[model samples]
Target: MPIAPAYDWVAHHAMVSPDRSAWADIDSTGDGAGLACNWREADERVGRSAAMLRDDFGVGRGDRVVMFSMNRVEFIEVQFACARLGAVFVPVNWRLTVHELDYIVSDAAATVLCADPEFGDTAAELTQRTNVPHLVVFSGAGSHPEGSVDYDDALAAAANRIDADPALLPVMPELTHDDPLTIMYTSGTTGRPKGAIITHGMSFWNSINLAELSDLGRSMVNFCFLPLFHTGGLNCYTNPAAYFGGSTLIMRTFDPGEALDLINDPERGITHFLGVPANYLFMGQHEKFATTDFSGVVTTAIGGAPSALPLLQMWEKVGCPLIQAFGMTETSPMVTSISKEMAVRKAGSAGLPGMNTAIRIVGEDGNDVAPGEIGELWCKGPNITPGYWNNPEATADAITNGWLHTGDAAQMDEDGYMYIVDRWKDMYISGGENVYPSEVESALFDLAGIADVAVIGLPDEKWGEVGQAVIVKSPDAAGSVLDETAILNFCRERLARFKVPQSVRFIDELPRNATGKILKRELRG
Candidate 1:
């Protein structure tokens, strides 16, 4: 197969189909605040913003810009603008703390920072610490700091026409297949976050695969509620939607009532939807869920955590089959996905790998494991990241030969279906957000009277796995009682709110192995 040369997503969309609906923000509150833009409008905004960035903000090719915001129309527009300018886009997870946020911004060396009103306070704090020259506030409603510029104001100042000098402009670069496009910071499980360097070819190939696999094209309508910062949302929703010229219903935040209303309405044209198990669980429990008609839903992809059998059954009863999938940020996020044809047969499996993607279960010695035997999941494909940014040692350890070592314990059946058994890393995913045990442990260490802490995941009815911290306090701290609120408050300052432990238990001592390693398995009991 001849490899197609790389092209920026914005350039590709503008050249191919300029009038198709590229993105839209659905009004979850039923207000008229919803925003929608077709491909032409999206291209114009990106072009205008690119020109403004070059002339006003001094951004050019190879420069990095950080976009910190929730799931909104502007979030997608900023990404397009970055691509148009040939600048590497770094999207910060909005839930991260000031410390984590500052680390990523500095690491990316972002010359320009764009933020939504909700994150203005954190952005203001970051601007004080970094040499970022420009700050553009989105949503048009925020009180800007003294030096910041309004996003709408910048767009207004931009020329309506694209500049003639394509080479002098940012989008004219000859983007090779391997050239870096986006640097996504993985939700670090054990230590500080690592930036996964993604290329134009890798992202484009994954989007094509997803579009073909999910039967998404110009005729399909996709409802995207996942955060664009995550691979699941970007590759699956935004990229694929652009690839097929399909319409997308975007939501800045996931609301059960609003989601139900959108899916049930026939005019919404929602044929496909994707979310984690927690989303399905929450929607399943909503009072209107049972009454709402989901007959129009063709496919619903559920992942992040295992989907409970009961939840699957509930969706099936409403004529919507749930397909479970398994992937990580490193593999361009799509490894194995449950196919619609095998939806009922392979109830728990994450299906087989897509075209040209290989999956294997390897033991400690790097040999393949037998069928039905548990081992670390390893993947090799065009979609896999070349390596983690600026971490050669870690990258060497992670990618053996060409296979990306996924720190997930999984089993494969005789028919080649993969089933997730457990995670090798001590990472708990609550409501689709990756919560690292080390990050939570570091926060717990700051508590004044804390002696030792071990954080583990416990099965929950809503969130697939809620964080449970078992603390062993000092002898003098025996009389000190620790509650959920106190421990959560302590974490809020150092970590994201989602990473905070939902429950805290004061134990005399945590189970430790002979080598003094905290035994999380025993702690789970």
Candidate 2:
């Protein structure tokens, strides 16, 4: 059955359980100062924000409101407010430089821009290039550009008016299930970024997929340390948990030590957690990692990229089985995920196709391959984006015959589990054998003294290309002076000789994008 086209989960939950905690935000100061809002409070705040956007900025249906800030409750509220008014919310990556941000803001043609105090400088620079008419500083003590208002003041004004007479707020436009909900820009690993048009229905279905896959319940307490701009943080678990009447505790930004303390705090009672593999890696390497207790966590998920086997084993050793998922921004960010029950049994598999999701592994001939044969994975589902926001050429190239051809090379076992081997473009053939960097990195991560690692194929004379490993050795290993020979020998025991990295280089850290995904392209360069 289709969800009601006009239904708003926030509004629905606010009405059904007015007193239930909807969202919680931790301060970035790392002092544990935080704030939370119940459903009723959230509804009122969202309504006020909608009123403010409509009245103050003339923002309404089809208009874009760009949020360039770090994670916070206001970020989520602004997004919901945009939903309430049928406006598209574009959450810019705060990690982006001013030039990159300018392209997104102008491309989006956003009328209102919101910034966090931490990014006041970037936001200020953006106003000079983009024609964004209204600027609001959301959370920070730093001074904003001229003519900007404090986000809190804007909301308070609206709330005061609404409190006196709720009827003053403009009537929300009737929306269909297909109304645009968000315009999430891709990470642009290969080319210029393109906004993926996410619809209300796409968000709804993705939440359903998450709830079913994770067994999310009203009692689950989700800790969201991932950035909200990404689908992993927005639609993956946070939104789904909210839809199920569960509470989400969000960190203003990921602080490894702070996250560790939260997980150990019995009062927080964190039951569900989600992050990229790098987040888990950093947390595991933190000084207190060995002493922290993660036993209270009922569900933990890893996305962005496949996690290393050693990282998986580390978390499992602490009684927190980390389930790996495969997705991208184009598919409402979730196509397949390993369920908690099967986390250990199918440790590396991306799991089964999600609800209302179909998968096909197609070979070069454009035909379905036999089970266990590697091919490009194509997905068709309600959660898949309609198309890229403005680039029809890119959209046409991406979606065909109702299937989004995810540029991921994968294999499906006889039992129907999907193992994402590599990005189709990332796989390199060496001596007629296919070598996936992820596979090699997983083996290297299993070594006793490795902290982080990235692998890329480099030109070779004997073979067309050979694997090169870039590693960040653990502190203790550095003290012991672990060398390339140990890493190569470690791989020889666990992998085919041909698949082991032919060369190794040590680095203080790996180059990563804002979302904690290692930039292999940078490594290759």
Candidate 3:
């Protein structure tokens, strides 16, 4: 069944549950704020946004519409608008350098770049370099780039045009499973980022997989603080909210303290949330963590990196257990998720695959590994991405037959639950023994006054490779005399001799990418 003639998710919600709240924006000030819209408003906004893209920006079906922005309501609006207009949307990470973003914009061949005002200069530069026909800036505090269209003004004009005649709304294109819904660039280790083509079917199936797994409902209120460009933010729960006629509170900028206050506010009624471990880690370290209420939050999920067991345990003790999940950008970002019930019981597990998805750990021979044996993880399902955009060689290497070769080392227990060991590239052989850095990091997180930590392999004379601990001291340990010997002793108490980091270096913070994963390459460099 086509989305238009039989089952348009957004249109169905507009008709059946028009008054249901669909979205809100959480501004940066630690004060509760910004736009709120219901399903009816959402449909109209999507229509108007699509109208603006087509009539004002000259975007057409199959054209790439690129967005470079932080977390905001406008990002999702443009996403829906592109889908409605039958254009393949690209959400470029706002944290990328101009050069990196330029590469993505050129590769995507975007006709119009809808961006946040904060990135006005970059957008203008991209327009000049890429020859983009239009640069539309979202309405905000920052200066609008020269000659760029104001998003709000364009939307108003689109509304007027639609009022003059509703026919101005985009005519539904005959889309198929092959039609791309989005192109998300994944920053894989050791190479330039590759744009993964997430198809319409993948999005739809992911929404279904996540909704059923997370117990999503029409009344649920999702707190979306992750970058809208990341699949974790886009598909995890935000898209599921739209799919189920639910609501979401968007974050213009993520601040741990503000997030804590908002999550504790009973009036806002936040039901679900998701974040990378760093997001949760900072929140747990905040002064507000001791008292901020978690009774209102139905569930919160953690992914993007392996979380420290103690971090998960701390959240569990606070009555808000963070559900550990496993996924990547190419998997529509919801390959598997642990339920709240299993969150504590299976504290270190990534849990089972999504109901509609299938994942397996395979040995070097490309056959399934026995339970408890570590192997490269592979996944296949409707929710998985078709392949990378434009790069057929990379696509051919990544996806074998119908399966995506996820370069993650993982193991499965007898119960069928999965445990992600570590990235194959990240796992270093210490004296001929494989040492997973996450395990060492997890043990080290149990230490107080340690805000953040990352373990990377360093070449050694005696051993082929050895672990190096990069520590970010919390405020309590700001000037404390915690020397390398003490840290090594602490790890020696918890880990095997081979797993302990050979060196310890304290720093103010770890170098984390936009999605919250530690940038080990930078550390190695």
Evaluation by lDDT, superior candidate among 1 and 2: 2
TM-score per prediction, in order, is 0.94, 0.80, 0.81
Q: Against the unseen true structure, what C-alpha lDDT does each candidate score? A: 0.79, 0.81, 0.82
Candidate 1 lDDT over 55-164, as tens digits, reads 78888777888888777777777776777767778888988888878877887888899888767877888877776777887754544676787777777767533445
Candidate 2's displacement at residue 128, Å, is 2.3
**Candidate 1 segments exceeding 4 Å error:** 1-3, 28-33, 160-170, 475-485
Tens digits of per-residue lDDT, candidate 3, 203-259, equal: 878888887657798989999988788888888799888888889999876789999
Backbone atom clashes (below 3 Å) for every candidate: 0, 0, 0
Instruction: Rank candidates, lDDT, best first.
Output: 3, 2, 1
Off by over 4 Å in 3: 1-7, 28-33, 426-525
